[model samples]
Target: MISRVTQQTVQKSTLANLQLNLSRMSDLQGRLSGGKLITKPSDDPGGTASALQLRASQRAAEQVARNVDNGIGWLGTVDSALQTSLDSLRRARDLTVQGANGSMSAQARDAIAVEIEGIRSAMLSEANTSFLGRSVFAGTSNTGVAFAPDYTHQGAPGSSVERRISSDATVRVDVDGSAVYGQGPWDPVTATGSVFGLLDQIAADLRAGLPISDHIAHLDTRRDSMLGELGAVGSRYGRLETVQQGVQKTIMDLKGQVSAIEDIDLAETMVELQSQEVAYQAALGATARVLQPSLLDFLR
Candidate 1:
């Protein structure tokens, strides 16, 4: 009876060791198959939390990048319009200068005035530029044309809009059209009126055969004002571009961070997985040998 009891005890111990080795092999298999140790919170609470945070940051960064893209598009429209405005103003100024010359007859000056009027009309049309159905120059108001039908600015003074590109980064989405188109330290129009208005007045003086040296002189001053406004618009364009670059950099950094948190290191993971596979194979071999023992072998 004592000998039989000893045999039973040995068998039970061998079975327990076999079960333990098999469990270890199963764990190794799991690790080899799944690159990450924490597929779920139950697998590793801290890793799960960290991954969640990283994913969240990545999503936020993507959305901000979209915002930056939209802002850049809007800025591009403004830049293009300002370029057109400058060109038109230059042409108008030339016409004014030509008309002011004494060698030209009144008929010639009047003919030139017609052309100036055309340029002025074109400038007015340009001022009403829109982006995605919203007025680029309409202060904060997006409902309609940037300028009134009479070519006056059509929104609240000093109203501006902004867009966020990152947690700490933001940029203004517009520069006032009135400011860019006329005179200012930043007035949208001159005391006399907008560029179109001044051009109309100049054209009228030339048509009436009135002495237009004074009109030309006023236009030259307004030309300087227009040039100043163009410079300011150019500066704003540069600033928006600078902010866009910053947002791009921030997006790149955030992408790297996200990759670090969520993406597997392929080289390292492959090495670890190979190691786990070898370990599991070794454990399987050991357990097979241990569990292969039979009653006949024991008797022998």
Candidate 2:
């Protein structure tokens, strides 16, 4: 049999080990309640690495969603400006038709010319549309205005803006400004020529007492061409809406994936925590009985 001193030492050692285990159990309880797998680097290196990667991916996806939102804003602005331009063009066309009746006096035509000049200035302002300090139609020059103050456009001929929606997917966020406003199918409006310019020229001829029906007919052709350009841009806006819907779906999918990776299964974690608490209580009861013997009992 061990001496009393030896037995006492054994109990002290057992109590020290039990205290250490209880401290560990308390730490686990806190972590389980908090619903996190690891609180420190020493607790779980691999899990921490995986969690960081998931967070990064989630952040990147959110930024792409923001990019899509900004693109939508820009498209809406362009669409609005185009709608205004179309209305002004139609109104100007109507005025020209009325003025060509030959019975209208020069003063009456001059009044119409004044209104057309206003529409010209309005169109020039629309061409310079902006969003968040950047010109929506400026091609690649983020720092430059889309249209010069004199109604001229500048940028890469067909530069495109793109956003990375996913690790493997990229989507065009903007239509090329040159494609929409400067050249190609709608090139009749010179980069330097304001829609106002044509209207002003017609107004000047009418005021100068020239017969203007043929000139009005030519202006009609340009008006129709501008309408066609508006239609194309409207189609592009519709396509962007479609792309935005797809992006929303992708964001939902990515959120689901990140939740799967980072969120603890609450039901499972609660069950394990309860079971561990019960086991710890049972261990405490057993340890109390074992550690409760007195030095007097050993002497007797």
Q: What is the lDDT of residue 232 in candidate 1?
A: 62
Residue lDDT tens for model 2, 155-179 = 5656766655456765554444544
Model 2 spans with C-alpha error above 4 angstroms? 1-24, 40-50, 141-150, 154-192
Which run of 10 residues does model 2 get worst, by summed lDDT? 183-192
Per-model tally of clashing residue pairs: 1, 0
C-alpha positional error of residue 133 in candidate 2 after TM-score superposition, expressed in Å: 2.1
lDDT score at residue 18, model 2, on the 0-100 scale: 71
Candidate with maximal TM-score: 2
Q: What is the C-alpha lDDT of each candidate?
A: 0.70, 0.66
TM-score, cand. 1 vs. native: 0.76
Number of backbone clashes in candidate 2: 0
Model 2 score (lDDT) = 0.66
**TM-score of every candidate:** 0.76, 0.77
Clashing pairs in 2: none
Residue 87 error for model 2, in Å? 0.6
